[model samples]
Target: MKRRSLIAAAIAAPAALAAPRVARAQAQHNWKLVTSVPRGLPGPGVSALRWAERITQMSGGEIRVQVFGAGELVAPFGTQEAVESGTAEAYHGSGSWFSGRDIAHSFFTAAPFGLTFDEMHAWMYYGGGQELLNEFTNDRNLQIFIGGGSGVQTAGWFKNEVKSLDDLKGVNFRAAGLYGEVLRKVGVNPVSIPPGEIFAALQSGTLDGAEWVGPANDLAFGFENVAGYMYAPSPVEIYGGIEFGINLDAWQALTDAQRTMVEAVSEAEANRSSADTFHANLQAYEKLNAAPDLVIDTFPDDVWQALKDASREVIDEVKDTSDFHRRFVEAYYAYARKSTEYKRYYDTPFLVERESFFS
Candidate 1:
């Protein structure tokens, strides 16, 4: 009782869930966590297992986290809802998957050309993005972490080669967040499905094309198996970041020692996820390219321009209602614009630095 009340003093809305739950904790000794990702997706689940294992070992069997691979327990998209409602102790997922919760979530997952993984970490941890996201979570009896990212992603796989907007029109695709909105403008029938189903969706012919994470994840989803025309420079996505959630009651019920372990392990999971994607995605790309029939393509200049224009329209609509989102876009682009301008002096113009040996 003392521990419960004391812990509740520091938390804002969590006290509601913590107080009643902790009084009963003396009756139960360990925790069980449910996650949504499949066994191997190069995202949150893989990162979490490594850290969760360490916590299990250190706790000497007192603390336990049981990871439920996708569809093993709740449906993949149901993770956050499960956590909030106490069906699970935690959730491993991406903001992109739950953008339906709040448009503000889209900012965390990565806006089009928003921040890269490291840049987002910088902004989330030091630049107030974390505080903002938690503000949203805390309202719902949930607690969370930055949960790292899968970095950038390929545009998608396509049946017919896309030379221009003409190719994009009437195309049925798998996409998420504001990207879906942008796709609609370009005449794509964009659908949102959980990551676990992308490959099956593609395989069954329900989807004309799809893109999931970077190369590594795409490969894991068997993207290479169906690659017809692989496209790049996804005008709709720059970075795809995953988000982790902990039930507020479950988090607060832990002892101080347990609290430290949870925080440390979650942070470690974030780091591992980022690093794993960096190296693994490189290998996945090789597999994609190794196939003789695979046709790799980059969007022509006009196509890129058209997509960019459509994306801007989507951004403006998102900004109109979300001051938080608007501010984020403003701050992010502020940095990007400055970065682009500075790079123009030395990076954009390429004669291979004629004065160098190569010249």
Candidate 2:
């Protein structure tokens, strides 16, 4: 009887020890991620898909992410709400689209005449931008991550040449966030059109002009087919940022290891997205530049000056919104001013010399 009892106890002890191990092994997460752009729409679209793949691979299948592009599961603008409602676990898109909720969101996307991709990242990763971002999103029950960016987008595709600042007046243009507001100050009528409908709007004359992204994406969308003039170096969107806003409940449920993996993959993908956009834009720009009857031009010096002046007025309105807005604006411009000072001596001169040497 004693030997039988001892055998039973030994067997139960092993089973108890193995239960936690089995549970740990089976701790899997299957998440649904939605994006604000159609699947395979280039740049942000590509980055969203890649982000899922990397997380699945990196987690060794412990975590799997399924991506739904714009309108696949919800409207492009509905992504944030979907995540908050648990209809989707996460969302990938530009923060600017949601600036109506908090004006500071525009900074998360791209500030008017603001930081470049590298400069934005410097502010986000080092200059306490992320901390403030967390605070801002926390109120809305979300956690934010800066995943990617489209660098130095072109001004846009215009049906007619913008010969003067007055030419911009009353033009129904598709621009977002502070860009749209700044353009408003300059007399352009800003319209909000989804990515999928931009071409149709332009073709039907519903929109006089539109700025989607830089060359790679704009070329793919065939903006040139409708608009004859493509302008460059948009002051408003120096860097078009892409971000992931995860439902706070879902984010908090992640294990420490899983959270680390997500952040690591996101940060790594940011670098990849920038590099991919640069190379693709370079190749696409060459193609667009050679396209027959397409006038690739830059905004005139006077127009550029007017834009800068309007941008100041728009930014001032934002700064008066709240303490948070003031902080974000201050931090952003501090870095921008510092970067400009250094780049004037470093990058700007080198680029001028390089162009001269090549010419």
Candidate 3:
């Protein structure tokens, strides 16, 4: 009986010790995520809220994220600093918001006339984009995840029609990222305004034109009521990509399983948000087109050609900003060229053929 009791005691002790560790591993984490978008706004804002909900659900409530919109926890452009200072665990915003820190940051958001939606996704996930981003953020003591995107955006809302390149000259345009640089090259004065302030700028004649997300977000912001002309094929951001920037220390504090869960949910949100924005934009476009006061148009051929030329110049100038910037730009363009070629052969022709039948 004494021998049996000794063996049972040893087994029970080990089990008891292991049980606490398991419970600790499954402990709950309540994290705060600050966004560069206003709460409930379409596209990035809505996506952030959904991402937080998903993280909670996927982690079985072991990890709960409380999302704060622009200016709630920090100003719209202050998200990066907030994360870096450990004031917030994470941030959801476009990488372009940090371009002032390094122009190369714009590559992660969008490049003027750069990669399309599918191509951007391919480059970021399969190509070296993610690795480059990780390196960049790591230097700042933060980690980045490609969170969400507004597939392809509209040109902008214009108070008047833009019939030629001359119309763009001296126009007070509200632009961001590389698009602002490209617009400047073509003689437009790019106004730096936060997303929330854009509507008021336009209404008060502070801005001649502005490009927000797509029809859904634009309509929600009442751009249609302020501007008469809505243009298509935004040359600024072919694809608007948003990122999840988390503090390195906070991220490392998570268990391996928790880290994996965060990454998996972020990628899932990227796809889900893009699709949601696309569908919403489609519905909004249908409604906007029916409005008699609004005029939907595409840029004239000459204007588009000039913008294209200016975009090339802007790209060349930007690549020389720094060694890292040069490398990123070169890699991006190389991948973009390859993807463009593929689309030319496959996607472009298929779309043209399909449209011919419809017309």
RMSD each, Å: 5.8, 9.4, 8.9
| Colliding pairs, model 3 | none
Q: Estimate each model's TM-score.
A: 0.80, 0.89, 0.88
Cand. 1 Cα-lDDT:
0.72
Q: Please write out the lDDT profile of model 1 over residues 1-359, one tens digit for every residue.
A: 44334334543233223234344345334555556666554456667676567777775555777777877778867988998898888777778777788787777775765666666776766666666666667667787877677676788888678887788887779987777787788788998786678888878888888866677767777776765888885665665777678888787767655666676777776787778877888887888889888888887777777777887887788778677777766766676565557657765465356557475
Q: lDDT of all the models against the reference?
A: 0.72, 0.83, 0.81
Per-residue CA lDDT of model 2 for 262-325, tens digit only, reads 8778899889988999999999999998999999989988888889999899888888989988
The candidate 2 region of ten consecutive residues with least summed lDDT is 10-19
* Candidate numbers, best lDDT first, in rank order: 2, 3, 1
Model 1: worst 10 consecutive residues (lDDT sum)? 10-19
Clashing pairs in 1: none
